[model samples]
Structures are given as structure tokens and as C-alpha cells.
Target chain A: MEHLPSEQSAAVRRIVAQHKERPGPLVEVLHAIQASFGYVPEGAVPVVAEELNLSRAEVHGVVTFYHYFRHTRPGAHTVSLCQAESCQSMGAEKLAEHARRRLGIDFHQTTADGRFSLEPIYCLGNCACSPAALIDGELHGRLTPEGFDELVAAKAKPAT
Target chain B: MTTTVYVPGDAGALSVGAGEVAAAISAEAKRRGVALDLVRNGSRGAYWLEPFVEVQTARERVAYGPVRAKDVPSLFAADFLKGGTHPLSLGLTDSIPWLRSQQRLTFERVGVIDPRSVADYVKHGGYRGLERALQLSGADIVQAVTASGLRGRGGAAFPTGIKWKTVLDQSAPQKYVTCNADEGDSGTFADRMLMEGDPLSLIEGMTIAGIAVGATQGYIYLRAEYPHAHAALKAAIAAAYQARYLGADVAGSGRRFDLEVRLGAGAYICGEETSMLESLEGKRGEVRVRPPLPAIKGLFGRPTIVNNVVTLTSVPWILAHGAEAYANYGMGKSRGTLPIQLAGNIRRGGLVERAFGLTLRELLYDIGGGTATGRPIRAVQIGGPLGAYVPPAHFDTALDYEALAAVGAMLGHGGLVVFDDTVDMARMARYAMEFCAIESCGKCTPCRIGSTRGVEVIDRILAGVDGERNVQLLEELCETMVQGSLCGLGGMAPFPVQSALKHFREDFRARV
Candidate 1:
């Protein structure tokens, strides 16, 4: 296993310690680690397993089973487009195609510029205004190709 | 005096730019020197009319809708604060036909009050059920729920009282009350709405359960998709703690009930009760075999009462109003009201909470205003991803659990995702299989393997490669999954495909 950076290892230890006392704290601990760092670093798995008194395979199995946890670092912004039945009825598939072409990335892939990572979310519970997308955790609905472009452009703008 | 304006902070409202509209209103208010008390409340579930702005006047709350940031200046110019007229104005908020027609027992305070304020919650009849529950014995509370005929609103339709009673009967000292807030269904948003709008009700409901079942701990297993709801629930739980509604001594009754919100990773199977329990235990969200129900032994090997967000949220209403009052509203078994979510390709998609007797036609056309695309209505997918699709012929079927079951459909989560005439049934059937393949927990072979086979068979049929044989194979595979699967994810995943084959078989025919 690759050696984790000193600070990243310390951060992982801190997150695990914060939630290790709860009834079932593995998922919560992982969430905190992901929240602190963009994704769960590969090196932190053994550390979490050792701290929680579980096998390294148990922690790794959990990380792979749930779709929410990420083993890799994502782009600067994450764009999750709804691909479920509700959004499908409102042209989500077409919108998804447009998103891919515009972003130059497919689902689960980061853009070449590392500005955006695209993901397919089943539902965001924003079905009322369908063809929804969550860009960097902010929900946007009634998204046309044009609307999606505008949102991407706005997010891509550099801070002054 | 400061004029009060209400804008929804609901995810649905925010998705359509309610946040921008709120900012614009505040900026405009500052510029005009108007004394404004702008409040970000929850959505009314009339999502078509969101950023559904309401202003509190002396008489009533005036309504204006679908407001954009650009419309703010014009709304101010029209003196909307004093019930002024504008093109977007829809008169009094309460008097709006769409909202006024339905019975909003569970959602009464959702769009009306500030979500985070416990004092505001108390003022609006929020804790009345908990207060009433505090006065009664656990058995009496359970009996009231049983008498109310309340069933699980999370697609299973299990009796809420029986689940509680089992936990109440358990001899275990460390029992739990887990609210399944993992609302992963495609068209469902009622759980999300209530949590965001009136989270105190859910907190109150869970507290009542904890007090009744002799459980001291509660956890809300929320989905990770709803960050807004997470924030709302966290804030509400804090306020409830600070206000003494949730702590070592809940509401000063000297009974202990501690509550916390635990987030679920993006696993659709976690919506299932057993899978949810496993997920809560910080493991893989695989479905557990029944006979050892969550009520008897669940959540770290203790008696646990697992109820949906809507089911738990509805408890407060049943306790506040008498059991008969709730039982009086619905048809036969499905008592009380259901917060029916109208979504997808519909003109007026939103949450419509009503008694259980209304026909799907009334909901789809009268309430939903038909398809948003102005095309003829084709099909409606009732329930979630695992639910069956109903054709236009069955649209008149009443929205009851048994009525829907009679028509080969289930009222799973009371979500109606409408589709227009342009929809291709064959493609939808394929998507169903695909979704199952993606979300199946791999606990059961029939679900894990059969779903993938189902998908491939559909693809072969669609490609015109011996269509008849492949279609037959697909049917056989579905049957295997239905009969052999351990949980609903595999069992009911075939419902949509089977329904499409039964109702719209021509969609499967290969075009030469």
C-alpha cells in the first residue's frame, strides 16, 4: 500500500475517532472522511479498519458496495444528472447526452480540464421540475440543453 | 410594522431558483426602504407555482407564483406586500383550488411555518400529538394508532401500530425507533418535503414512538441525495434538543428519547427495511430474510420499530386528532390521507395529500391537468421503480391500496409518474430491468443474475433477433426473479415489465 500523507492520515484518524463511539459508526465515519477530503483516500482504508477493529477487507467491501462512496478524487465541481423514471419521462436521457457532449465527459468521468465530474443520480426528489441536475450540491431543474450550458458556464467562472 | 413575505426553501422550489428570487426580493426591499420580514418556508407542493411567494396581510396570506428574480421588481411595484394584483398573483394562498381541495393533515404546517423554529412549530399545532402522547400510556397510544388504520406509507402498507406493538411487547431494554427517510423512489418527494418543511413533526412522531415502545434512541436513515433535507433535519433536531423535545428527558416527562440523523450512501436497496437495518449497522445494504422482522430483533440485535418518514410523520396527526377522525377520511383499509406526489411529464406536478378514494383520473387530469406536453396520456408508473405501470384504461381505478392491487398495481409511496403518448413502453420495460440490475443487493441470485439476464433478453427482442423466443425467455426470467428473490427489489422489479407486456405488447414487436 502507498504511504498516505501525514496530514491526510491524521485527518482520517480524527474523523474515525469522532464517530467510532456510535452504535454503527463505519458509514458515518466514511462520510466524514469524504466530506473533509473530496473522496476517501485509498490509504485510509487500513487505518479505518485498524481503528474500528474490523478487517481491511470489510472496510474495502463497504466502500465498493455503496455507489455514494468514491475511491478517487473528483473534479472541482460534481454534476449529478437524474436518470430515473421521472426524469426519463421529461427528456433526461437527451439532457444526459447533451451534458456529456457539452462537458466532454461521460458518467463517472471527470472533464479533461478537471473542472467538472459527471454522475448519474437516480432521483434528486426534484421530479416536479424534471430533467434535474445537481451541480456542486445545488439542484437545478427544468434543464434544457441551453440551461445546462449556462449553469456549467456560471460555475466554471473564476472567482475575482 | 414590517411586512412579512414567504418564499419556499424546499428543494423543489430551490431547483427552480427560489433562492435567487428570495435574494432579489431582499435586495429590492432594501432599495425601496420597505420594512420586510422575508421568511424562507417550505414549498406548498404546488411546484408549478413555485417560488410560490406568499405575503401575510391582516386578513390572509396572498399568493403569487412561479416568481423569478426578474419578477421581483414588478411584484414590488404592484405592492404585492399588501395583496396587490399581478399576472402571477393567484389570490389568497389558502383559497387556491389546487391546495385547498386536498386534506393536508401530515403537511398542514409544511409550507406555512418556518421549519427550524420550534416555538413556531408549537404555535402551529406541531407538538399537540407528542403532548397528547405524553399524557397517555404506551398501550393506549399503540391502540389509537391501530384504531386509526394507519399503514406504512413507504410502499409496504404495513400497519404502523403492529410494528410498534411488537417492539412494545419486546423484553429488550435497548430498543430503537428508526425512521426510514431514504426516499429513493423516482417520483416520490413527500418524505423530502415533510422533512424540509415540517421536520419537527417527524421528530415529534419519532419521539412519540420512542416513548411508546420503551425505546430510548432513534435514528433517521436519510439518503445522501437530499443534502437540503439533511441540513433541515439537523437544524430541526438541534432545535428540538434545545427546546427539550428530544433529549434525556423528552418534553420534561422524565422519559428518555434521543434522536439523530444518519445518512445512507447511494444504495436504492437501502429503502427496503432489512437492507436499511443492515446499512444502519454500517455494513452492506443487503436484504435480510424475514421471520425475524425488524420489530422483534433489529438494529444491532435489539427490538426496533422501522417506519417510513411519511408513516412516522402521520402518527402525530392521528394522536392529535382522534383515531376515528383519521379513519373517517379514507376508503376501506387505506385509512387517513396519502401525500400523493404527481411528477414526471405532467402539467401540474406536485404533492397532493388526500383521502384514499379518489380515482387516478381525478388525480391525473383534475389535479394533474393531464400531460405537460399536451399529448394524449399514455401510462402512469405508480409507486417507485419497483411498481407497475397502469395504462390509460385503468386510469379510473380509485387510489386505494386494494383498488390498485386489483388492477395489477400497488400504491407504492403514492407517487404517480405520468407519461405522454410519445412514450415507448418497450424501452421503459428495458429500463426497469436495467434499474434492477443496477440496484439489486446481490443477496439473492434470482435478483442479481436474473435482472441482468432480463436486460439482455429485452435487448435481443428489441433488436429483432428471434423476438418471440427472447420475449418468452424474458417472461420466464421475470417469474424466476419474482418467485425466488428475497426482497421487493427483485420481486417487484418485474411488475413494470410484466405490466408493459400485458398492456402494451405491441411495443415489443420488432419493426421490419
Candidate 2:
């Protein structure tokens, strides 16, 4: 799958229009753009900076300050496992190693088939269950290798 | 008269399936053909015992918790149908040691009252600060805050009273009050908890600030990830407005204050006051330069009062009980309670609010009961990502903001992430820079590009590069990010990255 959906540009334009009135709304604008595009594409930065009356550097700085904003397109399926203290207590380190080995990709990179991307989530507030992962946006808790593989299998399986 | 049984409806409880818990109770009540009084209450901040259920009887509320929907059938069978004690029952909810131990000045009514009911907030000593604040001069209000010694709880422990004094003293016609609720710190969730459990407290806090600082409008820049909190806050704000607790001429006290909730696009950097202001104005969350502090020129280039959720939440307590009562809580110059988020490998993980003097050892062993894994804790990171990695050797150190700083660390946010024996300090140190690289606003060179290259340097060091040179290069890079970066995103990002490397040199050497 392409990192960004084909109509990503249209989404960026729509977000910029919604937040044009407020002063210094560059970050909000970028977030919407990124939401529409998955990552904040290099192409959208100039337009956002221009619309918000901010220098390009200033716009770029805000984007970089936050870890949530991705600059590249995610693979078809993205799995962010929590590594915060609580999640780690639940063996997130071991889980992360399992994920990396299975997917054959480190934190920020995509898999060869473009079927999945795995990343470390600092925390997703599922600490009580521990070893939580967000399969896309859904929270999955008490994860084992089998549970992870089951979820991965669904994402990996071809749709009819 | 409406009979109501309060159950904590905070997001944490909800995350652990509070919806199902609520459904079970309602279903049990209905099946037995019993008239019921159920009220979803805010979090009491006692997270360990969640889905904390309480039943309203003629006299007092009986509590039971750590409940599930599956347990409902058993509860029904046991005739807990009449608010009687069961195996899960913990007697009176207020008497629980964990609940009673907390200095719940801000969280006073959270887990006890109906969140959507405006009357509940008012009845529980809500808006009393705004009522009192309206009668005082702006300077007097600011002075009272200064007297309270309340510091910003969003990690930067700058005195909040001082910030208010500056903004109050500034002569600007247009000012904005911004609540930094974009709580992206991994191990911390106080902001989200406050918003979900007792949003009125935050609204009251912001309104009080508006009255004190001469601002009419406020915005809560909330993180997008907390959809439940956003819904709760939005509903609470609407209730406040309907009851005249917010909007123009609130409570007819002749003081005008209005607030709106703005969803942050999941950017951690926006937690910084300036970046928060930027995001609120509907832009990409970015750091702005100082000298033109938010007090004088912020949010549309107008003077602004930007405060963390905790700092402002304490306002009502300061005003109601007087600043001296609050100021008397803490040990040193850091004179106020801090809600330290205990997380990571810990058996007990939740918020612990106390005066600023508890040692890390006490927090770890006494409060936390050591690691959840039951292994010896090797290292602990106090504060969020940017915090220093503290070894057990510094176990005697106090939890004061200044004390932490004295030992080459700063308490950014009170997120203590513990790591056990199996952890690798070198790998942890490298991940910090990698996190910085991924999240660095790229505003400054040291953080933007430096973080990416910092990872490379760490890799080289790990792959048998000249150890001494690699260490020196890492140190030099940290200094640049510290001096050159615009905000805490880069300024403090090196603390965890560098401190782990500094204190755990053997770990890094072992990798090589």
C-alpha cells in the first residue's frame, strides 16, 4: 500500500481551510493534514505555513517537536505497542523484540510486503492490562505472541 | 427526590471496561424489579481499584470494585441487591485507606458526585473560588496564588503565582487563558483524569484565572487520543455554561469568563505552553521564542495566561482555604503537593499526591511495593522522556524539584517509569535520542538533525566505535540541543538520553 492515500492532498487542503482563522494554528493544521495524509508530507508544509502566516521553519519546528506526527506514509497495518513503564512491566521489551523479529523491521520502517508497520508507542493508557498494542486504533491488551500473531494474521490475510 | 448511586466514570475506569460494569449493575437492578439510583461519578484518582461501584442506601454509600460484567450475576445471586456487603465490598468508599490518604483538594468531589449534574458540582464546593475571586481585586487574586506557592505541574515547576502576577501586571486589552491539556507524556494521565473525573474543577480553575488575569476567554488544548475525556469535558463545559458557571458574567458575579475545548492533533510538543497556544489558534503545535512570553504576547500576539491542568486545578483550594494552607504542605521552596504518576514495572501504579519531600526509595518500595515483576529495580526515570535515569545509588535523594535539578536532572512531569534488572541502559539511552529524532520539532539544528544523527553515533558506539570519542560526541550533542533548541522538546530531551549514558557507562561499554 502507498504510504499516503492517493487523495491525500485534498484532505490537507480541507484541514487548512477549517483552521484558517485562528492565529498560530500551524500545529493543528499540520495535525489535520497528517491525519488526512497519515504523515505530514513535505509538500503540505509550505501551504500550511503560508496559510497560518508562519515562517516555514516555524511550521517545521512544531511538527518535529511532537512524536505523534509521522513524516512518512505508514504501511497498510500499523502496530504501536506501548513501552512506557507500565507496559514494559508487562514485558513490552520482549514483545517488541518479538514484533521486530516477526515483521523484519525496526521501529520506524515498514515491512517488505507493505502489509504492516510496527512502532513503539510510549503509552496508550492501557497500563492496567499491560503489554498493550493498538492494532491500528483499537486497543488490544494482555497480548502474547499468539494473540499478536492472530491479529497480524488478520491484517496479513488477503481480502476476498 | 432522585436517589443516586455514584460509580467512578473516569476514562481509566472506562478503559478497564466501566461501560460493561455500569451495564451489569443496571441490568441486575432491572432484573430484580428494583427502582435504582445510578450516577456516573468522576475518578477519585484511586486507579488501582477501578470500576469502583457504590450503592445509595438510606444512610451511606456502600462500595465494591475491581468489578466486571461477569460478576454481576454472582452479585445478583448474593442479594447485594439491597446495598449490603459482599466479598467484593470494601465498606464505606470514603474510609478506604488509599482514597482517604490522598490530599484530594483538587480531586475533592471527583469520584463522589454526578459529573453531568451542575447541582452536584455546586453542592460539592464547586465555583466557590470563582464566587470568592469575583469579590477580590485581580492583584489580590494573583497575590493569593503567589502566597500559595503553586508551581506549574506540567513538568516545568515555575511558580504559577509568579506567572499570574506577570500576566496580571501586564497591560494588555486582549488576553487569552490557555489550559495545557495535551498530556502526551507516556506514564502520566492526570490531565486526562481531571478532565474525565471532575471537569468542573478545571473549568472553575480556568475561570478563576480569567478573573484574576483579566482574560474573558479560555481554551483547553486537549490531546486527540483521549476521546472519552474530550466528550466528558465538552459535556461538562456545556453544563457549566447552561448553569451560568461559565460564559459572560458568570454566576451574575459581574466577572466574565468563557471557555472552549480544542482537540490537539496528538502532538506531544504542544504540551509546552507556547506550542499549546499555537495549536489552540488552530495551527501546527510549534515552540515560540521567549522574551515575548505568553504573559505579554501570546495567542494571536495578545497577552495570555497559559497554565497546566494541575496548577490551575489547585486555584479553588488556594482561594477557599487560603494560600497559607496550600503553601504549608510541601517541605522546601517547592511548597505544594505534586501528583507523582507511579508507573512501569511497579506492582502499584497510579497517582500519589503528597508534599514535595518523599524520597524515591519510599515511593518505590513503600508506595509502589517495588517492581510488578518482583525483580530488583535497576534504574528509574523520574519525569517523562526528558527525565534523568536515576540509579539506586541516589535512592536517598528527595523528590523536590530543586533537589532533582541539583543532581543534573529536572522533574519535567511527575512520570516515574521504573525499569527492572533485565533492562539495558545503553539501549534505553539510544531510544531516547531516537524518540527525539522522531518527535523533534526540527525547529533547531541540534534537536531536529542532531537527534537523527545522535542515533547513528549511538549505533557506532554500540558497534565498537571509539568508546571515549563516542561518549564525548554524545555529550557535545546534548549541550547543543540544550542551548540551541527552542522549547522543552529539545531543551530537556537530552536529560534521559544523556543521563542514562552518563550514569550507566558500563552498559554502553558492554554493548561495544
Candidate 3:
């Protein structure tokens, strides 16, 4: 088992404590931990399991089950392209291919520079303007290959 | 006098650059020294015309849209703030032909008012249903819902009233009302729009459910994908709390109803009611076997009322107006209006809330204006990924529940994803199985294993490897999944594949 730093362990305990009173607080606690940390740290799983009085396997099973919860550190920005039927009708498959070629990475892969991570989201409820992509939680619809490139380029620039 | 300009804060509108357009309008107004009162309202469901801007004139709100940030300068020059003419102008928002044709019951105030304002919600006849529900006894409230002919809008088509009646009849000290806001259906956005546009309606509806079922607590099991909706719901909930429409003393009725939103972690299976309950309990989103329905033992083993966002949201309208009024709108078994979503390859794709008798021909061509790519529309997939695909022959099928079922289709959540001739039916079939394989919870065998096998069989057929035998094997596998799976996820996943095979047989021919 990986050992979490004392500070990280304390943060996990605090996150668990904040939501412990609520019924079925494990998911909420995990969300809080992931929000504070980029991903659910493996080392913190045992701590959460201890605080919630659940087994480590149970905690680990939950963390792995949900697609939203990441296991590794994410890049500076995450790009989620809609891959469902509506988006597919609007050429999302082609757009996905273009995204992969542009990012030089497939879905669920991060760029070597750690600038962007690409994910295939089932739907974002923005189907009216299909072939939608969420760039750092901001949605862009009717996205052409060029639009995708521009979005990536904008994110790539360093902050002033 | 300051001119009031309406800009949609709806997620659909924002996706098409409404946020940037609003900023441009603000900046342009300041530059021209024009006094402007910009209100961020919800989308009118005319997504083709979004970011659909409206200006309040003496007579009505004039519309202009598909507006870009660059068009802001030209709009200002034309004095669009005063309902001035512009190339993008669509005249009066109310009189727009596409929107004017439909019947909007649940979405009455969606694109009209600021979603965050409880006062605006009240002004538009929001809490009247809750007020009515407050006056009635629990059994009376249940009877009213039963009389309304309201079915579950979450694709189950279960009687909303019966579910409530069961929960009402249960003798439990702690019960709950759980709103399934996990709208994971690919082509659907009605739930999202309602949540973002008029969240107070949902909040009010849930409160009514709580009072009706003796459930003081409520939880909206919202999906994590909709960050916009999450923010909107949270803000609206806080406002409801402040106005005393929520907390222990809801609307001074001396009843307790507390509501909060819980985020689901991107599990499509969680959209399933039992799976959702499991996920809410901080576990893997595995399907729970029926016989003990969620209505009997749901959400922490309590006799719970589990309803869809639209179903719960519609409770206010039913309570506000008589049940007969709602019942009179739609056709035989399926009653009342459904918020239909037009998406995919369609030219004028958006939300259309209408009574259930409208045919697909009216939706696809008359309203949607045909395919966006100018190609012939080959097929239309209604009711999410699990729904059957209808070829052009069955385009005349009505949007009613039984009407669709008669033609081997179902109006699951009222989403229509149109596809043009360019679509490869073979690939789509494979994708259906693939989607099922990915989203299926491993608890069930036919769903978990059958889906993967179905995908492989389709792949082989596509690759020209014993195509005939592979197709047969795929059909058998789909049958097994349909008959054997514990829940809808596995059970209905084969509908699209079977429909595709039944309709477009030539697509499955050997590639070589």
C-alpha cells in the first residue's frame, strides 16, 4: 500500500469528516477529495475507507467504477468530445479523429506536454448544436476541426 | 428609459457562443452610451436561432438570433435594443412559426424569465401547483396525479400517480422523493433545459411530492456532465431556501421539505432508477433486480417516490390546472404534452414541446426543415441510444407511446436523432452494441457479456468474415440480452441493433 503524506492524509480525513453526517457520503467525500486534488489519490483511498468504516477494496471499487473520477493527475485542461448518437449524426466520429490527430493522442490520453487530456463524453445535453466539445468546462458546439484547433491553441498559450 | 434585452443563459445557447454574444452586447451598449438592461433567460428551444436575443417592446418581445459576437456592432447600429430591424431578426419571438406551432405546457416559462429569480418564477405561475398540493390531503394529491394521466418521462412510461400512491400508502417515518436528473440519453436535453431554465418548477414539484408522500427530504440525482445545470440548480435551491419555499416551513404551510442536488459520476447506468439508487449510496452503479420496485424500497431502503425531472416538473402544472385539462391534450394512453428534442443531422434542431399525437413527418420535415447537410434523411433514431431506428417508410408514425410501439419503436424521452443517407447502418449497429458493452454494469450476464459478444459478431460481419452466420449469431445474442437482462440497460440495448438489422439488411452484406 502507498503511504500518503501526513498533510494529504489529514486533508482526506477532513474531506470525509465534512460529509460523514450525510447519508451515502462516500461519493460526496470522493468528489470533494478529487476537487481538492486533481485525481483521487490512491494513497488517500485507505484513509477514506478508514474514515467511512468501509473496506479499502470497497473504496477502490467505487473510485474505479465511475468514469468521472480520475485515478491519475490530469493535464492543465481537459477536452471532452461528445461521442453519442446525436453527435455521431453530426459527424462526431470524424471530429473525434481530427481531435486525436491534432492532440497527437487518442481518447483518454494526455498530451506529452501535459497541456491537454482528451476524453469521449457520452452526451453533454448540447445536442442542438451537435459535435460539441467541452474545453475546461466551457462548451463549444458545431465544432469543426479548425474550431477545435483554435480552442486547443488558446489553451496552449501561457498566462500573462 | 433603459431597454431590456433578453440573452439566454441556457447551456444549449451558451454552447453556441451566447456568453460571448452577451459580453459583446454589453460592451457595444456601453460604447454607444445606450442604457441596457440585459436579462440572461433560458433558451426558447429554437436552438437554430440561438443565441436567440429578444428585446422587450411595448407590444411583445422581438427576436433575433444565431447571433455572433461580431454581429453585435451591426445589431447596435441597427438599434436592435429597441426592437430594431437586423438581418438576424426573426420579428416577434412569440409569432415565430416554428415555436408558434407547438404546445408548450411544461416549458411555459423556460426561455421567458431569469431562472435564478423566485419572484419571476411566481409571476409566471410557478408555485400555484405547490399551493394547491399543500391544501389537498396526501391521498387527494395522489388521486389528482393519477387523474392527470402523467407517465414517467424518463423512458419507463410508468404511471407517475401510481408510484406516488404507493409511496403515500407506505407507513415509513423516513421517506424520500428522488428526482432522476441523470439525463444520459444521447439525443435528449429536455431535462437539462428544464433544470437550467426553470429549476424552481422542479423544486416546487419535488416539494409537492414530499408533502404528498410524507417525505420531508428530497435529492436530485444529477449527472456530473452538466456543470451549467449544477450551478443553476444550486443557485435556484439557495434562492428557494431564502424565500422559505424550501426549508422546514415551506410557503408557511408548516410542513418540512428539504431538497439538495447530488452529482452522479458519469455512469450512464446510474440513469437507471435502481442503479441510480445504488450510485447515490456510494457504490458501483449495478442494476438491482425488480420484484421490489424502487417505489417500495428505494434510496436507503425507504419507500421512495422516484420520478423523472419532467414528470416531477409537470406536477406543478397538473396541480395548477385541472387534471382533465392536461388529459385532454394528448392521445389515448399517453396523455399531456411531451418536450421533444430535435437533434443530429436536422437543419432546425431544437426542443419542441407538443401534445403526443403529432407524427414524425411533422417533426422531421415540417418543423426541422429537413437534413442540415442537404442530403436525404435515411433514418431517424428516436428515444436515445436504446431506441429503435425508423427508416423513411415509417416516418408517418405518430410520437405517441403506443403509436411508436406499434411500429417497433418507443418515444423514449422524446429525442429524435436524424441521420442522412451518408450514415452506414452497419457501423451504427456495431456502435449500439459497443455503447451497451461500455455502459453495462457487470452484475448482469446477458448485458455485460452478451453486449461484448454482439459487438464482436457485428465486427466480423462488417469485416466480411462469414457474414451470414455472424449476423445470425448477433441476432441470437440480442435476443438473449433482451429476454435475460435484469434491467432496461441490457434489455433495451438491442432495440437499435435489431431495428437496424430488420430495416437495412443490405448494410450487413459482406464488405468484399
Give the clash total for candidate 3.
0
lDDT of 2: 0.78
How displaced is residue B171 in candidate 1, in Å? 0.7
Cα shift from native, residue A34, model 3 (Å) = 1.1
In order, what are the TM-scores of chain A for the candidates?
0.97, 0.89, 0.97
- Evaluate candidate 2 and give its CAPRI docking class based on DockQ: acceptable
User: What are the C-alpha RMSDs, in order, of all predicted structures?
Assistant: 0.9, 4.0, 0.8
Best by DockQ: 1
Per-candidate local distance difference test: 0.94, 0.78, 0.93
TM-score for candidate 3 (chain B): 0.99
lDDT of 2 by residue, B1-512 (tens): 44466666776776565778888878877887776677888766655666677777667777777777788777667656456667788787768776666676766776777878788888989888878888899999999999999889988888898888888888877787999887777677777777877788899999999989899989888876776788888999999999888887788987788898887765667778887777776555657878798888988888898888888898998898889999989888898788778777777777778888888998889888888788999988888787888999988789999888888876766878788988887787787888777666556787788888888888888888887798889889888988988877787878887888778888877351
Scoring model 3 with DockQ, what do you get? 0.88
Model 3 lDDT per residue over B288-319, tens place:
88869777899899998889999999999999
Instruction: Score every model by TM-score.
Output: 0.99, 0.87, 0.99
Query: Considering summed lDDT, which 10 consecutive residues are worst modelled in model 1 chain B?
Result: B503-512
Ranked candidates, highest DockQ first:
1, 3, 2
